[model samples]
Target: MPKSVAGGTKWTYFASSNAQNSRSPEVLFDLLVSCSSEQGFSQVAYGALTDAEPTRRPEYLPAAVTVNFPSAWRERYAERRYNAIDPVVRRTTMQSAPFLWDQLAHKYQLQPGEMRVLNEAKEAGLKHGVTVPLFGPFGQLSVVSFASSFDDVDPEYRLSRLNALAWQSHHTFAEIAPSSEGKCHMKVALSEREKDCLRWVEEGKSSCEIGVILRVSENTVNFHLKNAMRKLETNSRTHCLAKAIRPGLI
Candidate 1:
């Protein structure tokens, strides 16, 4: 489909559903995380899945921008570094449409590895879901997935709303996610590594711990931190970490 064809989908009503005028990426990301519930999803996960599919390598695990996932599920996802096998990740890499997870499951025969991830997610309370594949102007690919307990879902209505939401999210994210990071916009650029480092900081991980997790040297982690501090304009690590997290830079 022509990108604009999807881009032009009307979301005027969706925008007005909330009276918020602040396009602060922080507020927007929080709203995006919960908006799926309005469409009847019990849980939602939004992310900046890397433009390139993650090769099962430690170096790229930190590149994903995920929000609002269940804590336990997120732990398992990271422990396993599931991106290399996540069906949603594969679909977002090529699609700009909102699709059912079931549809994707059927489209590709799942390897045992993929099936394990899906089953764990199901046990984690995500019984049914739709993924909104959002594409930014400069070819960045992100996604917002909505899920719920097993129940009848109105595919047409839900996907229509998700499609519209995907388009809106793409533009909003592009506008705030620094241009240098992938999409050019209103914010200052923070290298993906810097964002990743700060996110680990928020998780209470030390530089050495993060280094082990992300497969970089502690010195490299410190280097990214110093650079993030320079870009964020705060001298102390705590303040810089706070700033990076406030607008969801992680």
Candidate 2:
């Protein structure tokens, strides 16, 4: 065991098992916080694929409170809408790899409110955090984070171990995130045609472009897309991509 996490090892089992068994995003968040607590960390947050036809924010699980960040900071973050300016999440969106806090400091300067949040994060004793981005079937992207305040901790080791944990949890999360599609519940089950259509869309294909490649009419391509959306229960192509890919549909 690494010395930074010596006394906090119990969290390992708790998080892994809970990650394995989570029935919903709420359950997952609940487990994430529990694990963070065991590791002596004061904060943790995560977002995952949700069942939304058009893939709106409401379909995504609202930020569930797992740790106690100052309510004032939370209010300010929401009020000022820092999510648009959040460098951490933006970076997460770009990478398949996990990220650490230090990597962002040099590129993005924190505004006063953002800095206050960062300071709070630091004060909570968080020396480091690991953000794992999980990619699913269509174009689904989800992030799982584990953090700690103990400065003595080695983030590399934690990230390596936690990434394995993240994969396991993602698989489990996929199983539960979609609740309506009996056989296809949790994961998206895409046919070859549907998968092809979605893949083209991800590559920025217009229906006509996709039709040209598939040797079908643009209307045919659109039909496949609509079928895919129906199968994924997504109202729009983008949501379908996000959900299908996350659930491993493609």
Candidate 3:
């Protein structure tokens, strides 16, 4: 059968459903991971799958880490530092929702540098991939992705299945994985304004932009952020985000 058109009502349905219920990241990831088979894909990973806790600083695992993508591939990608050139990772860092191959493939023309990386991925049998970068309500950045060997696949069907599975995956993981690092031991409470400010920050908004959006002065925005930082007991905005996510304050 011919591949279904990607930009259509079917795709809209998936997008709408995902937007309506996004309370759980684990459920979303699990759903994406489980849909690999039906979507004609293989392997899926969200968040750092590494148990290789650092030695001297055993507590150095950042709240944000690369998800699945074979150990060997990761090493090679790092050795060559392909991540800087991998447009998917770079672009997805800025988006809140999931993204399919076509969106990236079409949005940015593959420059020579990008083509080389794409060819490398293709050679490794990763022809198509979908990435969902979840910026947690707190400052966590978790990426869930599915890879496949097929190009020009039926996106409508794949998205339909992916959409169906994302919620359940998000819910299950959140329930089992608590908001805090110790799961239950670390609890940081934020005021409503603090939560609001941190959530927008995680989405990559600046104080000025957030002020405009929230109809508050930039100083007011900064005040909320400052209060959030004080409550979270973090030094910088990035650390504040990480701490918020680690403790599930947002």
C-alpha local distance difference test of each model: 0.61, 0.57, 0.54
Give the clash total for candidate 1: 1
- Clash totals, every prediction: 1, 11, 7
lDDT of candidate 2? 0.57
Evaluated against the true structure, the overall lDDT of model 1 is 0.61
Better of 1 and 3 by TM-score: 1
Q: List the residue pairs that clash in candidate 1.
A: 179-184
Which digits, one per residue and each the tens of the lDDT, describe model 1 over residues 224-250?
999998886655554465345444565
The regions of model 1 sitting more than 4 angstroms off are 1-23, 51-61, 64-66, 180-250
On the 0 to 100 scale, the lDDT of residue 171 in model 1 is: 49
Per-residue accuracy of model 3 over 17-63 as CA lDDT, tens digit each:
65425644444443444445556765564453223211111222232
* TM-score of every candidate: 0.56, 0.51, 0.48
Off by over 4 Å in 2: 1-26, 36-42, 49-70, 106-117, 123-127, 179-250
Number of the top TM-score candidate: 1
